[model samples]
Structure formats: structure tokens, C-alpha cells
Target: MSIETSEPTGDTRSRAAIKNALGEQARALGFQTMRITRPDTIQKAGDRLLTFLADGRHGTMEWMEANADRRRDPRQLWSEARSVVMLAMSYAPETDPMEALARPLEGIVSAYAKRADYHDVMKVKLKQLATDLERETGDPVKVFVDTAPLMEKPLAQAAGIGWQGKHTNLVSRDDGSWLFLGAILTATELDPDPPERDHCGRCSRCLDACPTKAFPAPYQLDARRCIAYLTIEHKGHIAEEFRAPIGNRIFGCDDCLAVCPWNKFARSAHETRLHVRAELDNPPLADLLPLDDSAFRARFRGTPVKRTGRDRFVRNCLIAAGNSADRALLPFVAPLLSDPSALVRAMAVWAFRRLADPDAIGTARAEHYGCEQDEAVKKEWDAGTTT
Candidate 1:
């Protein structure tokens, strides 16, 4: 998997100076840390990805299976890519992110989604770095954030950014688990940084804290049972088994990342673009459930939560409402029983049953069961009535 690269025909001192300048420029661009690694450093990551896919750990994210080879080795993605420059941007929360869990009537969004999308933020900074590196080395370069088919964690670890924690997220001693990784792949041969080593020993706090027990083992994740995946990626009716465990997390889950002990040394993000928006911190489920498509887009216009679209996002809100035991949300959840999207309608049924009494559930089912066309929605009514 290693590619043979010829030594650069430049003054060694000049090259060292360029490397040091690049690090300084990256810091100036708001990246917390920057390091370099060869493309061949992550050759072994492909096999682990294959095993993860075979075990169905990726769930409905079929793109991972489609782009398997390119994700494993950066060389396959770009033939001339001899070196990878990895960058980490800190998005650690200023306040305790887990506090939102206590407010059952509020919807909890993952810490990263509380501000503008990181992909947009990171890509702009990465392109600036790539432009500078290309001008200095006179070599072609390509930049990628999370949007590309790259194993960012492995490459970041290879570049000494951080070790992949037991939760399979890049955990930095400096940035904790709140880092957003980006990469610059270039044809130029640059010195690689030393790789980071695992700091997690016998501690299984992350694994034990998962609401749905998504982790089968340390350093592995099953996306199907993950609340983050269920709310953000899974586009259909969430299995009844995971609904209660999903709690009030409307967009993504952060229980595992928030519990990591290494965060004791982590500081709040200095990047202004990553600062948490006050409105999104702990949005009321009642406020979110009433949003139409246009209103939803307007409310979360620049944030990551908008990408989930109104249907999926409201569906998640309904799940949170069901668990909230807040009867006040019943009026908001009632009209959605006839929502155009079957996904929303089914969850509305579930939420209605939870908030209403047995007599109210019977009365509502009697009125709507015959009019429901989607078999799944009807099944929800059936399940609600029986239970």
C-alpha cells in the first residue's frame, strides 16, 4: 500500500521552514492543531472497515460500503497524494452539554450541531491552507472535510492529532473529544508527525453510558441502535425498542462523548463560528413540533440540524415528546397524526398514545384508524390500542 516518493530537490532548510510556517498558518486559520502523515499510514484501516460493514455496523449508510477502498487508503482516492496534512478544530462546549438531558420537555442536539455546520466552516479553512501549501511546494493539492470518503480519525491519529478513543472518535489530550477533523492531501513529500498512542485503559464509561447500548465492544459502534443515527440518519419509523432509550435527543446523541474523563483538560472552543447558539441550546419540543417545512428551514437555516429536513427532524421531536410525558404537547402532536409523511404520522401516533389516557387513545383511534392509509401508521394505532 506504500507509494515510493523521491526526495524533494530543494534546500532542506527551506522545506523545514515551509512546514513550520504551514503549522503557524493553520493555527492562524483557527485550527487548534495541525500535523502531517504519509498516505500509506492507514493501509490497515481498510480491513477493520470491511469487518464493520460485514457486521452491519454502518446500518443504512450504504455509501460507506460503496466507497470502501477509497476510504481505507488515501492513495486510491488521489494517485499523486504522497502526504496528508491533518487538522483538528476544537468545538468543545462552554457549559455541561449533558444538562439538557434533565429537561425532558426540551430537545437535545449534539454539541457539534449547536452552531453553524462544521463541514462548511472546516472546508473554507482547509482550502485556504491547501492554496498556501500548493503555492509554496508548487504541487497539486486536494482538501477534504467530513464530506469526503476518507478515514479522518485514522489519518488524524497517524498525524499525531489524537488517538481514536473507545467510542471510535478522535480524542485529543489537548482538544478532548470535541475535535472536527479535516485533511489536505498533496503530491509533495513532507515529513510525517509521530502518531498518538491510546490513553484509554480499563475505563468503559463511554460504553456504559450509552442509552441504547450501541457499542458491542470497545472501539466499535452499531449505528442501528445509536440514538444519533436513529434521529439523524435513520429515515423511517424508529424501532419501538429504541424509542424510550432515545430520550429527548431530537437531532443527535452526545452521552458517550460528554462523559469522557479527558475533557477535564479541554477548554471551550475559541472559534466564533463554533460557538453555541442560544436558541438551539435546549429547544423546547413544543416549539419544534409545530414547525412546517419552511419554518424548520428558517429556524435552523445555517446549522447542521437543517440537513435532517422537517419530516425526519419532527419525527425525532415526536419521539422526545412521547418520552416527555408532557400532556401540553398533545395538541402539537395531534395534528401531525395526518402528516403527509408516513414517518411523521407513525411517530405522532406513538406520541399521542403516550401523552393521552387509555380512554383518550381509544377515542382518537376510533376517529382516525379508518382514515389512515399507511399500514405502518395503522399498525401504530393497533399497538397503541392493545397496550
Candidate 2:
């Protein structure tokens, strides 16, 4: 395939001007860093993800399997795409992200979700970047954050943003795991940067810190066992074995990311809007258990927590409440036995048994148990009673 050379006029000079202008524009946009990368820089990442999907490790995230060709090659996503510009934003917090686990009894929100949803925050930046590029190059462009079928981690890795750590997340030697990734696909063929090399050698901090042992191997993850997947992605009853390990992680989990030694180099986030809200940071499980659907939506608006919805999120809270052993939460747990959503009711019944008197369990079994018709609920009730 032959490549187009300069027009011998000013187009050649204009393209160079655009490339330099892009870096200057990105720097002015508060992006911690940005790099343009060649298309094939991401091929190895595609191979790794394809292997992961082929082995069925992605679990219920069927989109990963559905977009095989597009994810493996950026050209397949958009034929006009000539280069990918990967951008990174820092979200590092002042306090340790892992401190929530010490309480074990308090709910732990993922650092990314602790503030506003990153999709909302990063999408604005991505759009601005794309708009600037389009204006300069006079060519069409598309922007993507976590929303598109494109492989973000791989592209970010290829663009010299960072290497994928053993935890399988893009991690910068400068920013740790506290960065959010964004990308802009443009038709202009910009100069590409050299890719970063893997620096996770012999380090097992992330692997050893996982509560659920979600990593089956280095640079691979099993979503089925990940707390983040279970709490937010996997609906219905959580697996029995993982409940204890989940602790009070009511939304997504960050054990692996929080434990990395590279975090010492991370700077605290300058965006005050990304700071943790006092109400949500380490909130007690009891405060979250009784939020009705509308209340839940109202509370989590602009937050990533809204994705789980009331029923699924409350179900997660009930699991934490059951494991709390506080006994005080039983009163809060009892009323949900008749929650309209069977998933909620099922978890409530389990919480009741965990925090209720054995006699109360028997009484609940006799009076309110018939209200649950879902097979999964009935099974949890039966198992709880037997235990």
C-alpha cells in the first residue's frame, strides 16, 4: 500500500503545525499527559484480550466477545482513523484508597466512583480534544472514553500513557493507578511515540492484595470472581464463597489498585470536584440499606453508583449487612423481605437469617417466606436455615 506524501504546497507545513498545536492544546486542557500512537502498537494488547475473551474469562460481559474484530484493530472501528491520541487524567486522592477496608464494617466505594462518574468528567475532555483536532485537520474525528467498543487499555499502553500492570489496568510510573483514560481517533496521521515497556516484574502486591483472587494469572482477570464485577456488573445472587471476601465493598472494589507500591509516587488530585463526599466516603451499610428506588436514583445522580440501580445496589448492601454481624441492622433488613424486586427480597431474607434470631428465622420462614417465589431466593433461604 502506497502512502500519501506532502502536497508540495503548504499542506505538509499545515500537518506539522496541527500536530504541534494538538500537543499544546492537550496540555492546556488539563490532561496530565497525551501521546499519539501508530495503529499496530496495540496489536499485542488485542491478542491478549482476544485470548482472554476466547477463554470465557469475561463472564457475562458479552460485548467483549461481540466486537472481536473492532476491538482488535482500530481501523475496523473507523476506516478513516489514521492515529489514536490517548490521554490521561489524574484522580489520585489525598487519603489512602485502601483505608476503607480496615473498617470492614463500612461500605467502600471505588476511588473512580467516589466522586462524579468519570464518564461524565472524561467525556467532556474527550469531546474538546476531538473538536480541536477536527478544526485543525479539517477532517472527521471521533472520541471515546469507556463508552466505545475500542480497547482503551491497549491503546493507552501503545500511546506511551502507561504499561498494563499485573492487575491488567493501565498504570503510570508517575500516577500509579489513579488515572482515568480517554482517547480521540482522528483521520490525520500524526507522529507516534514509543510504547512503554512492562515494569511489573516480580511484583505481586496487586495479586496478593485481592480479596477474591480474581487474577488467574499475570495480566489476566476473571470477572466472575472480581468484587467490582460482582457488585456492579453481575446482577442477582452473588456466589456464596465471595460474600465474605467482599466485606463492605458495596459498589466496585479497588484492593489490587490500592495496594501497588507505585502509589507512593502518585500525587493527590488537584480537582476538588473529584474529592470524596463526606456522606459516601466509608458510609455505614445501614445508611444505604433502606434507600427506595427513587431515593437511590436521587442520591446517586451524577455518580457511577447510579448504574447498579436501587434493587441491585441494595442487594449488595444486604450482603454486607448480613456479614456485618452488627445485629442492629436486622430491623432494617426485615422489611425488605417483601421488597418488590425478588433479588432484593432474596438478599433481605439472607440478611435476616444472618442477623435475626434462630427463632426469628423460623418465624420468618413460616410467615413471610412464601412471598419469595424465585428459585435463587428459596435456595438461599433453605441454605441459611440449614446452616
In lDDT terms, which candidate is top? 1
Which numbered prediction scores highest in TM-score against the true structure?
Answer: 1
Question: Model 2: per-residue lDDT, tens digit, 141-223?
Answer: 88888887888888888888889999998889988888988888888878788888898889999999999999998888998
* lDDT on C-alpha atoms for all candidate structures: 0.89, 0.82
Residue by residue across 203-234, what tens digits does model 1's lDDT show?
89999999999999999999999999999988
Error of 2 at 109 (Å): 0.6
Candidate 1, run of 10 with poorest lDDT: 1-10
The alpha-carbon lDDT assigned to residue 351 of candidate 1 equals 93
Residue 13 in candidate 1, Cα distance off native in Å: 2.8
